[model samples]
Target: MLAVPYPYLIARMRGLKRGNHNYYKTLRNYTHIVAGSPFAEKVMRQAYELTGTRIYKNTALPFAWDLLQEERQQQIRREFTNYFPQSEGKKIAALLVFGDISKMKKTPFRNVNMQELADSIGKDWFFVTNSQELAEASYVLPAEYRERFGFVNRIMPTQNLLYIADSLVTNNCRFAGSYAIRRKPVHVLRYTGNVFEKYVQEDYNDMYIGQIDKEMVKIQSGQMRPDQQAFCKEMSYDNPKEPYGVIGEILTKPF
Candidate 1:
């Protein structure tokens, strides 16, 4: 069973409380799946049973889009450039592929074109709605542009897709992670208990890795900028024995 940290869950609930009208509407829709009417205890129970946590089903997409907004996107771009200055002048592409363009149109996926977007960004970024469409888009791109573009397929299993999508948003709209393969096709899977479990575990692992990264920054603080050191400290791991001991062992080994 996937267990989100209590703080994360509480923060999500707080966001839900402050969400806009559409967020509530989406919540209401999901709440209807249970025995009782929306917002009833039975509905909540059903939600817990299905997802292992209470979350507004519809809020994730909008939240993802919010993270992809112009300001956030630019911030992400800036961070990326700062980290990889050599990529500063490179074009970032974004492509969106969809199983049913019509269905996407009804949602935030409306009017987004993979090719046009790639051209607009003037970067090696691409977003695709589905794997098949991504393949098709890759085939049609101009030879020059093709080399600079990267594709993001959205048709992963719903849960995995949402997790990836959320990460993309949280990570300044960058696409990462893997989706399942089906006969060479890919589909987004809806969020599920197991998927959520994996998501939490992955996040925890990322946090732990980030902590270790911070310790490295501290060790190199004399060489790193003050601001960089500060940023690294925030991500520092709580348990340093493992890392410290490993390094000590390596350095002291006779072999």
Candidate 2:
């Protein structure tokens, strides 16, 4: 529906999200793709086979690191520690592998092999989800060798744990973008396997890990221009055009 009138809207910016039918349906019509993350770009490219000079002609711009402040993030992490054990030598890791409860078939949990991750990491692991009831269940574990997953009730507070922890392991869920935008590293799993690979994959695109680290290092070290943050906001060009571009191009170049 948005694709019908988005071009006429002044914003002219389109954001591709997870599990949304509209973005998938209108994939071919878009000329500029402002992906939530470069990982999304790979999914779209694999699913639709969009070429650089053809559809999505403009280079996709990443969404900014729009999240809570440092003090607030720390608060959430501290609260997380109350529920789980403390980290000794290695940093604790939080795993968020669940997605839309209404669509369980689409989640990576089905084939993720949780027991394997629990065995491999062999460290403090907190399994987070969007479900509240499950979170309560996680808290009351038998205090013995309980299930390998600890549960979190809220997404925001759970993500705050991400900031404090050393790493994150998620599927094609939106949280991957959280780590990406913040310049944090997240080890993505083979979420959803081939079921939705064309639409979403957890592979390492430069956006997810490599490039993000270097840029974040620059910001921390003050190697960036003083006005880099401000300049980034102004340089966000989404290749705007009249809504007619979708139709006009088809009519003009049917070949």
Assess every candidate by TM-score.
0.26, 0.42
lDDT by residue (26-77, candidate 2, tens digit) is 3565554543333333445544433342433223222123232477566766
- Best candidate, TM-score-wise? 2
Q: Per model, how many backbone clashes are there?
A: 36, 0
Off by over 4 Å in 1: 5-111, 124-131, 151-255
Model 1 lDDT, residue 152, Cα = 37
Candidate-wise lDDT, in order: 0.30, 0.39
Off by over 4 Å in 2: 1-68, 85-90, 98-116, 124-144, 147-149, 154-158, 190-255
How far residue 237's Cα lies from its native spot in candidate 2, in Å, is: 14
- Score candidate 2 by lDDT: 0.39
Q: Write the per-residue lDDT of candidate 1 for residues 1-255, one digit (tens) a residue.
A: 111122333233333445521222224433122111112222234323342233322111222233334565565656545543544565322222222334343433222354554454344332223334445656666766565433334323322233222112112111221111001111112112223223323433321112211221222112333432232222221221222333344357464
